[model samples]
Target: METISIQWSLVLFTALTGIAGWTFVCVAADEFLGRAKAAAFPAGIAAFVLAVVGGLASVTHLSHPDRIMGALGHPTSGIFTEAVLVGLLCVFVAVYLVMLKRGASDGARKVVAVIGAVFGVLISFMAGESYMMSSRPAWDTLLLPLGYMLTAMPGGVACYLVVVAAKAKDAQVGEYAKALLVAGVLAAIGAVAFAAAAGQADGAALGCVVAAAVLAGVVPAVCGALLPKKPQQLMALAAGSLACAAVGIVCYRCLMWMVSEPVANLFLNIL
Candidate 1:
């Protein structure tokens, strides 16, 4: 295999997007559990920051950032176009945070929540498509988006659980934390499985699969399963797992980018 430099823009973009997606998930899960008042504003702000940073990094990969507005004007560009759409979604999230700080009504909050969730899902898919759209066999699998979604959900939920566990005096919050941990574990397993299967056929892909499995699966499992019953331990496990998932996703993206594309007409000469 020939040596090549990693695409720093793509790596940074994926990392920021993962963080943003994870933050949104945690916030959404908090809302679902009736902790919206506490989680909503902070998570919204984090999401907005991450989304803006990721969006800007993505634009850096383009030939012209000033032409970004013109790119958004075009409606038929698919995932590339969706990049602008996700950026707009992040702006809405930022506005939602402002409204939240100003004491929005329940109805308004609900509307923002719904819109944010929709965009969260869209961003997740857009991240997956960024790689899957490439001709590389390592990333063309249908599982890529599913894996991304799974990792994001667990990472988000875990973060929310950790935050709640740290502050809430109520026993009910502990139960919720436990539940989210279990859910996160399951989601992590699914992500590891899908990534493993997707990478079974190629060397670069296999390396990604192994790295992800260790980070997203084995580490979390050992930490979460072996620790004594303690809130702090659980929180630590959750945070570690989230970190692992993020790393795994990055490795997956890097592998996809590393795969070499064949030159036109080279196949004819080889035969």
Candidate 2:
């Protein structure tokens, strides 16, 4: 494999979109728990926008964007699989949004929410799994998908907290902030451990990755959790945390890309 191209479009698609989808799940889960409807509309809008942006970013990865339709013919291809999942996810979110707009019954909304959330999870899985290649030891571990899932947890929580603070003033959002802080710490530790185990055992890049994870995830989580439980205070904390966590996720992706070393399979006997 040649040197990996670092494209801003692909980075946005993989990290931001993954976080956005996971945020949908978190918002829906809060609703399912019988929380107030204050966040439903905003969450739906966010999900739809993220899906659209992610799809467009994907298009940028194609050299001949017009030929992208040809990808559909190869259903087994990773690119195709991601495209289909993202498309379906967008549809599910749109359906949910439509139902909300029309003032649909609670039962109908719940069903659509479940469908959207499920598709969101599948999209995150495909984002990481798409990079799975045995030739690249750094990208071959199950840790890649697991790391995405873990990081998404705090990102989702932080985003939903912001929505809740702005729209609902839900006191329960603080609890989520606390939970996310603990989760962020755990995720940071897990990330470094996984990186070390997966051919990045020791290097300046690994150190940078570890530091970013702690800063991007752990520190914000701690601050958010420590904030006063007041709705207004929590909201401010959440906003700050969201920015930090977003930066952390981007750093993690860059490090993962940097660590990708393709194994050379040269047989001297053949020569």
Candidate 3:
């Protein structure tokens, strides 16, 4: 039997979109919490741009990109549902930024923020669900969505801290960054444990997975947690940490693509 294969284009697109969604969730959370106003515009715009790029890159995965519009009409399909959630998230972030620019009421902005956060998480959940292919044993576990959430949100929060620190230079943001780092460490650990529980990976694949987890979770957590208290140091540290975390996420996704074994057990496995 033939083993299932990974799709790099889809993987890249999902990583970009996943990060974009999580970034918006972080922005919205900050907005609602009233902790960082200056960070909103830049972060929101960044998220929107990421979403656009990912949405476009995803077309490469489709044999008929021109026919992609029909995806919007089918809410029942996981891909369609994920697409809709992504679109809604981008819209909400865009609208929130516009409202901010126009000096809209806090109440109005809060409403949009809440909406954006919801859609962000829903997108993450859908991302995992989208991979629930019965043909690929490794990708079929329920832990997939939880793993996505665990990694994406922490990555997103780190991205937000980088943006905010760069633009705002607010020392107070350090505390929040620290909290996020701790959360990220915990989430990353949880994700790794969950993946182990699935019992799909072995040997070098497992080693790579663990190493990717460290790069994604431990490195960023330590960097974020140990960020210098000075405002000037914060920006550089946060940005570097964010970049590291991103590489980790990409590694994780690549491994996910690499580890699948076909359910059929016919011909040789792809990995």
lDDT top scorer: 3
Model 1 off-target regions past 4 Å? 1-5, 161-205, 218-228, 233-235, 259-271
Better of 2 and 3 by lDDT: 3
Model 2, runs deviating above 4 Å: 1-3, 201-204, 227-230, 262-271
TM-score order of candidates, best first?
3, 2, 1
RMSD of each: 5.3, 4.7, 3.8
Candidate 1 lDDT tens digits, 72-149? 675765435558656766866776777778887766766776677677766766676655644456467767666665
Q: Candidate 2 — which pairs collide?
A: none
Highest-scoring model, TM-score: 3
The TM-score measured for candidate 3 stands at 0.88
What value does the lDDT take at residue 245 in candidate 1? 61
In candidate 2, position 225 carries an lDDT of: 63
- Please give the TM-score that candidate 1 achieves against the real structure: 0.76
Model 3 segments beyond 4 Å from truth? Answer: 1-3, 228-231, 263-271
Q: Please report the TM-score between candidate 2 and the true structure.
A: 0.87
Candidate 3 lDDT (Cα, whole model)?
0.72
Model 3, position 240, has a per-residue lDDT of: 71
- Score each candidate by Cα lDDT: 0.60, 0.71, 0.72
Task: Order the candidates by lDDT, highest first.
Answer: 3, 2, 1
